[model samples]
Target: MSNRVVQGRMVTPGTLAELIEGSPVLETEDITDADRPCPECDGDVIEVGYMPSVTEFVTGYKCQDCDWSDDDRE
Candidate 1:
């Protein structure tokens, strides 16, 4: 994996060391992680999981004081 960080936040370190990586972090409706900031809204990037059959990955990311929608990775 690249040592690159998205926007500024780093990906989980040493997370890919294992042979069988965990399931892809599926994004649900929309959530924000208070610890991580959102790249689009600059808000928190909450870790929420979605169903395995979801068409796309969705994560909740509310701007501190803006109307930006969540981030969807299709």
Candidate 2:
């Protein structure tokens, strides 16, 4: 009689060895602040996005009462 291993019915010790090695590590850093008030309507300024190439972060402010935005300045 010959011994044969079934695909789904077999699991070796190395099958889950990578899981016990270590957990993944992640690093995060705060880049900018968007807590400044809007100059036009005294609204809150929020962070829209960032431009890593130019090293510039874009911020936009929206007013609920006056409907003002920083886009109007550009």
Candidate 3:
């Protein structure tokens, strides 16, 4: 699905990417379950691919239980 429950609110791929990127993105892909867990909380992690700019595409990861998040840019 393109939408997921993040912490408590329902968020789309764009929103999820924003949570990781710390800003709005230009484009986004569907949200998916990551094959890993949160580092801090050991919670379920979700993945989303987004384009922050015209030339950059990033894969973002977010914990469903807490504020922990990450990106492929690292």
Q: Against the true structure, whose TM-score is highest?
A: 3
Structure candidate 3, residue pairs in collision: none
Q: Candidate 1: lDDT over CA atoms? A: 0.36
**TM-score for candidate 3, residues paired by index:** 0.96
RMSD of each: 10.7, 22.5, 0.7
Best by lDDT: 3
What tens digits encode model 3's per-residue C-alpha lDDT throughout 1-74? 98999999999888889999998999999999999989999999999999999999999999999999988885
Model 2 TM-score (2 dp): 0.28
Model 3, global lDDT: 0.93
lDDT of 3 at 52: 97
What TM-score would every model get versus the actual structure?
0.27, 0.28, 0.96
- Give the 10-residue window scoring lowest on summed lDDT in candidate 3: 65-74
For residues 1-74, what per-residue lDDT tens digits would candidate 2 score against the true structure?
11111222321222211112222212212222346676776654332232222443333333333434442224
Cα deviation at 41, candidate 3, in Å, is 0.7
CA lDDT for candidate 2: 0.31
lDDT score, candidate 2, position 57: 34
